[model samples]
Target: MNPTIQLEQQYLVHAYNRAPFVFTDGEGVWLQDDAGNRYLDLVAGIAVNALGYGDAELVQVMQAAASKPLHYSNLYHSQPMAQLAARLVQVTPFAERIHFQNSGTECNEAAIKFARKWARSHFGEGKTDIIAFSGAFHGRTMGALAATPRPKYQDPFRPLMPGVRLAEFNDPDSLAATIDDHVCAVIVEPVQGEGGIHPATPAFMSALRELCHRHNALLILDEVQCGVGRTGTFWAHETYGIMPDILCAAKPLAAGLPIGAVLTSGRVAEAIHPGDHGTTFAGGPFVTAVANVVVERVSQPAFLRHVSETGAYFQEKLQEINSPHIIEVRGKGLMLGVQLDMPTAPIIQAGYQHGLLLLNAGADVLRLIPPLIISRDEVDIAVERLTAILTKSA
Candidate 1:
């Protein structure tokens, strides 16, 4: 075993099933382990490293931000934080304000609070229930955990936050039956990342929006893994052609740094005031400085076009693979899921020997979310490596 892995096992809590090797460095879409072996990274830090490792502009921004004081808390005003909020609101069509958190989970927790607060402020009492769908992975925190319906993640943490109702994913009838006047919000992922990279259909999204409005409930889009140009659009919901009352984003925002943002419409923003929700380390100078550059670069028209073109090319190449183990290829842009007839654990382990880094959305779905900056050549390489992996796995 690697010395670092041994040390971590001894000292840290036994929670995560981590890879054995230690990554010493990374550049673009490739990562180098401590043994100096290079691997093509398709996971991209679980969709967090959108610009990839060692980005020039991101490095420069980090250097500049590090030279100054790192944290002043959220007590005082910050230029980077303010500027990042402005940039986010400007890019997001329905957002009028932004609230920063430390990760995707925190953003979802804050969104739930805001929804309940908004409902209470407007509808008085009893409108506090939240509707979530099956196969949704919002976050691990108490409030967000309640909405994520998987038995594996929820069973251990029983007696979760009350009033969280569950409906079937992509099923409008289930949603319509589940939602009622008592519901305050309906939270869902535009693209289900951890739940096997399932992209919500347009009809489902539209119906969700219409139902939320009809029942006076807030529509919260959890874009933690799909937003910020991951789906060839600035926001994943953009493809659905409907606006959300509250949108939660994180992961790729700071290009690998821990950060989360809750973008809200004016109506939702009005309900949140001083002391409704607060975070001490959120929206600090250091992280927001890097996030500003990420937002600016990823929001570019040319960059988004690259994601769209390469994503289509990638999907095409995956479908062309002659492996009989392959069942389907789904998802959008850089975020894709390859459903296999067999488990993906062995395939993921085999990728290491093939000089390829891989991730699995579930037992049988291989998730591919390479860096947004990955070129066509890199995509071809990934596809070729994946073909070999799938063939051998079968």
Candidate 2:
């Protein structure tokens, strides 16, 4: 057994069943294990490494940030944080302010709190209900979990945060039936990442915006996995031609550093005041400094165009594979999912032997969210490896 694996099994909580090999080094889109085996990375740190590993500009910023003081609590202002916020608001037209958190869950929690506060300040009491869709993954925190609506995840922790109603994803009629005057917010992911990579229809997204406007409910888009150019756009919701009142983002924000942000419209921002919500380590100078570079690079027009072109080519390659196990291919840009006729656990395990890193979205959906910088040549190689794996599995 690997010494590191043994140590992890003995010391760490059994919350995660990690892969056996220990990755010691990474460059571009490949990761090297302790035995010096390189794997073609298709997961991209679960869609967090948009620029891939060892990014030159990111490394430069990291070195500069490391030399300076890393943290100063939210009580004091920080240049990097302020600058990053300005950049984010500049790109996000509907947003007027930004709030920082440590992860996607924290962003969702803050959005929920802000929505509730906004509702109470305007509509008075009893307008606190929130509507979340089926196959939605906001986060794992208590408040975010309530809106996630998965029995396996939610059943374990029952009596979740109250006033959360469930509606069918991509079914605008169901949403209309479920939402009422009591609902303060409607939260949905433009592309459902963990729920098998289902993208919301433009019609559904439009209805959500219209319904929220009609009922005075805030629209919160959880773009944690699909944002930051993963979906060929800076934000996934941009494709829908509508804007969210509050947007939750993380994962690729700092290129793997622990960071999350909640961008809010002027109305939503007005509800949050000093001391209403905060974190001790969030928006630190170090992470924000690194994040500034990430945002600047990933949001570039040429960079985004590359993601779109590469994603289209990759999708075509996937469709060409003559595998009976492949049921369907869905999702936009590089954030793709392959629905399979069989369970994905064995295939994922087999990928290790073939020197490929893969991930499963749900039970049978093979998720392929490679680095945005991956080339067409790399896509061909990945497809060849995937074909072999699926052939043997079949």
Candidate 3:
């Protein structure tokens, strides 16, 4: 066995099924592995690398911040932290105040806690039920895992946080059936990523909004994967013409740095006390500084418009692949999936062999969350290679 692989196998917990190859470096849409093979990174570190790898601007930002304080506890205020909060509030319609965290799970956790607090404050403890949806992938922490409701993810951690009910995604009738006055919040993904890249219907988002409002419940949009220009808009809920009361986003916010945030309205924001929730490492100088640049760049009108145009073009080309195995192609902007009748594991394996990195959203859906900065030519290259690979598989 290779010494490095052997050492990793011996030491690390067998949790993730990682690929054998080790990538040495990356630039733009491509990564160079240990053996000098170049692969196009369609996954973008599972949609965390919105600006792509080795970006000059990001590198400059990092270099500039390297001279300053790298990190400080959440006790003291920092320039980047305040600036990033201001930027988040300006860009996100839902954010009256932003609470920073270290990952998507943490952000979702904050949202969950805030919802419960808000519910308890507004209508008493009875209104503490949190309504999540089937096929929703919130995060992996206890609170997030409970809301996720996937048996595979929840069964082991039995007796998770109570008061979590599962409704159906993209089905207003199902949401109506599950949610009521007892529910404090209904959390959903504007575009379901891990549950096979399912985009919620406009009717469903609108109805969810109305249902939450009618019951005086908070609406939480877990945009961890679908936000930050991945869905052709700053926030996926924007496309539906409805706003969430609490919006959680993390992946790609800092262009691959670990950062998550809970953006909330004034009602949800003010319900909490001074020490109700906090984080030790969130909104530090380094991460927030990088995030400020990332948010500033991604939230630009021209940049978002480009993403919309490129995403439409990419989807059109995907449909034009003219392959029999492709059952359907769905999702918005750059966050897309190609569903096949067959299991996608082999296809994903073949992608690595063919120098195209791919990710699986489910058993049958091949997820493509390439960088936001990927141009049409890069998209064409990816599409052409994917077509050839699919042809060979067929």
RMSD of 1: 0.8
Over 4 Å off, model 3: none
Q: Global CA lDDT of candidate 3, please?
A: 0.91
lDDT of 2 by residue, 335-363 (tens): 99999999999999999999999999989
Model 1, runs deviating above 4 Å: none
TM-score of each: 0.99, 0.99, 0.98
Go through the candidates in order and give the C-alpha RMSD of each one to the true structure: 0.8, 0.7, 1.0
lDDT of 1: 0.94
Model 1 lDDT tens row, 1-394: 8899899999999999997799999999999999999999999999999999898889998999999999999889999999999999999999999999999999999999999999999999999999999899998889999999988998999989999999999999999999999999999999999999999988899999999989999999999999999999999999888999999999999999999999999999999999989989999999999999999999999999999999999999999999999999999999999999999899999999989999999899999999898999998898888888887774
Q: Provide the lowest-lDDT 10-residue window in model 2.
A: 270-279
lDDT of residue 363 for candidate 2: 97
